[model samples]
Target chain A: MSSLAVGCRLRVAVLVLALLGAGAVGGGSTAHAADDGELTLDSIVNNVIVGHAEDGNYLNFDPFATVELPRIMVARTADGALTVDLYGSTKGLLKDGTYGLVPHSEGEGGHEEVITESSALQEAFASKAHLHGDIVRTSGHVVADLSITRHLIFGLLAMGIVLAIFLVLAQRYKRGVGRTEAPHGVLQNMMEVMVVFIRDEVAKPNIQGEKWRTFLPYLLSAFFFILMANILGLVPYAGAATSNIAVTGVLAVMTFVIGLLYGSKDHYKHMFLGPPDAPWPIRVILVPIELIGTVMRHLALAIRLFANMMGGSLIIFSLIGLVFIMNVLFGEAMAFGTSIISIGFTVFILLLKLLVAFIQAYVFTILSALFIGISVEEHEHEEHADDAHAEAPTSQTSGALSDRLDAVDDAVDDVTEPAPA
Target chain B: MTEVIAQSLVQPDVGLIFWKTIAFLIFLFLLYRYGWGPITEAMESREEEIESSIQRAEEALAEAKEIQSENKKARREAEREAQRILREARESAEELREEEMAKTRDRIQQMQEQAQAEIEREKQAALQELRDEVADLAIEAASKVVRDDLDGERQRKLVNDFIDDLPKN
Candidate 1:
């Protein structure tokens, strides 16, 4: 059979620069980058994370291509000597006879089996196979497979996208786009809605003393970065980095650290010492619970993001997989009939995934902001509490906006009424 | 085997995490420095401007209202002044008419008195003429009677007595 890996022609730079990869999962990949053989359920699902690597390094959904990234690995021989090496690609790595690729089925991870010879290696690098695998050393094993992954490349691409958007926006702001006047256009307006929402709806309400200002940059970055990544996931062949637990874990860990760094003395005290008023028995129980709770919540934070994104991708892949399964079971005509249902379900899920993308990004950032706010929150006696602090009015021209809107609405009606008449 | 796959799904890749930590740190730093600051500062600046603009608009509205009220008051004041002037004009016109009537009445009374005085003088003169004629008739009658009468002086004295005896009223 042809090489197992399947994909559309693509590159990170193009995705970053063009910022449009909707063609990845759509007609583009199916028409231009279709695999030579039939697709398997496992292969389709696995393809969500690992793009096809057969034709050097390629981004999955687009047509642009980049050179294969290097693989950095830790290997051990039968002598127990450890050596770290980098290769231009998996093909190059296998050429050394020092390391070989094993299919997940023959491997310990997903589908399993045994790999004995060069034939198995070829099978492992199937049309649906990825470079992320058990790389076996001759008579030894890969102690650490610290390879630069597809997800990592996408992650960097997502980052580059975020940087690109804001850099242009920063220039616009410097030229006084939203400053001297109200923001205009789709990009500015779209960005303003999120920024305003985060500030007024999320950050300000959580952080006190108007200290949301200090955390605004971090909050905005987290929101936009995750948002961009989540959006990129919806692009046909392009997926989200947040689908990986490692990426989300890093993000959560950042939240935990930031929370601690800016944490009030009382927060630490409350965590370790428990409520001072509680009896010693209760205190003993409460302290451990609080400590465990803190770690668990952050872990939960990471898993929640990963699971949601991963589930979405799985569903889409599975829905598409149904057609191929039908083709194998029945005939070509049935496959076409099955595609109708599959495409319908896929479209529905794609729509849901779009909404989910924004929600998950907002959720992660707001939660992080909340945790930080909690850490920095001051717990004081009721008698000493000040009640004067209230929500600052969001906009002075809130009424003006409506008034102007109404005026514009009337003006439009006036201008158009005569035409219809 | 399914469990292994399930476990692998969630298993965080160490290499990814290692790179992610460094990458995320840079992201936060670079974003804080470059991306977020200008955008947020501009927003805050715009917000302040809107607030001030609203304040200015409110002030302008109030000023306009005040000017309108003052204008209404002035208009009312002008109306009152006009009414007062009208009333005074009517009062002066009536006074002028009355004064003219009073002067005309005075002149008419004065003319009537002068005519009355001249009529009285003329009536006295006519009475004198009548008296003279009577005297001439008496003299002629006396001359005819003197042929059988006393003297002329006696006749004159008698007439004078008669005239004096007539009622002076």
Candidate 2:
């Protein structure tokens, strides 16, 4: 574990360097370093948004933008709160006068106007503190009446492409070309390795026969999807879409649903009423606890992914902010050292982030498989154990009965032998 | 701003952005139809191709093995043929040697027979000469003994007895 951690640290260093390099280019080109006092998620997200902003020229009323649409604007207020402003005009009627803020999540008329002047406007904007956004949004008549957060969209697209590539490679392997020797095509070969790795390393150990294959698709897809999303988020300007609680929650729920549906009768019964093997008193006490544990596990999956992504982003954001803060204290002379240190640490963290991204994905998939395995395990093993135990007593009784019979027969033989020949 | 917020608050509805859903669906549909299907089919076909190729390769290998076996059989047969020819030649050579040996034996037997016959003829000739000599001697002796007595009749009687006792040549 120490060696692994060291290696992980090295990787993190390299990753940080690469991310910093990317950030440097991005920051140098399209972003401005925050003035001395600013260091927050809101600022970073805002920088990313500002970097990707257009002059609002590409605006169209089409829900799905006609042409390639730029990313939405992300900005921060003076107090480090995040704002997501949809600033483009479309062909629709302009509802222009400055409007006050309202909290949509809360009921409309029941409470006081939650949308206060700056305060309510802030609610519309997601808080940088809690990763909330005060989103200024608009709708248009497009192919799809939805314009998702650019980060989510990118993540989705990336997932789709990655999935497609994997599927294609899988197809090629099935065709049976270059199988006898080593795999021929690079992608095909790599994919074969990955598939085997997931199946053996993740699925087979946890999941048993027929059911393993049945659940393999969902598990593999989820793992790959999360991985793609994570990597995409790592890219500057690309959002780590999985960081969104809703997305992760959905994925966790899917795992939960699968665990519920395909699970064995025993698993279901045990989940609610404890395992049949448990003592009567224990069963009464443990069933509810077990049920809660199941819920908590799935909930943990969601939180783990969400927290890890958000955490990585925050670290990187804070480190980069270190550069500007140092510039304020020691001027340009100390700025370079601070930049180097920031970049150095960032590079390391970034690498760990990469590993974390993959590890998390693996964990999610493996856990999903484990749940599936528990649900689908054959009852025969337990039954066999019971049978063996039962057989011991039966054999003993049968042996005693046979011995007694043999003794009686011997006695009869002795009596008959004397009068025989 | 308050009006805008209030209005949004009043209409706090999150509609399933139909266009977005449609777009996503289309994307999904395309992927399902074009991407996944082709990929899966390609895999299946690739598998089939590989399987057939392996089968064909196995078949070819089997054919090669068969041909090799046939060649081996033919080679063995050819070796047997050479062995048979060699054996036949050896047998013929043996037969010729036997015949020559028999002829040489016969020739020797003939020569021995000739020598034996010559020896027998010489002995018979010699015996004849001896008999002649004996006869002359007997006659001379008889003439000398019966010189004064009836010598002619007695000598004639002796000759007749000798002639009766002697074998014809």
Per DockQ, the best of the predicted structures is 1
Against the hidden true structure, what lDDT does model 1 obtain? 0.69
Steric collisions counted per model? 17, 36
Q: Which ten residues in a row have the lowest lDDT in candidate 2 chain A?
A: A90-99
Q: Write the per-residue lDDT of candidate 1 for residues B1-169, one digit (tens) a residue.
A: 2233445556788778887788888988888888888988999899999999999999999999999999999999999999999999999999999999999999999999999999999999988988888777877777677845767788888777877788764
Error of 2 at B14 (Å): 8.9
- lDDT (tens digit, per residue) of candidate 1 on A160-199: 8898888888878989989997787998898888888998
True contacts kept of 1: 0.57
Chain B TM-score, model 1, reads 0.69
DockQ of each: 0.23, 0.10
TM of each candidate vs. truth: 0.75, 0.56
Q: Interface RMSD value for candidate 1, one decimal?
A: 7.0
Candidate 1 docks at the CAPRI level of: acceptable
DockQ versus reference, model 1: 0.23
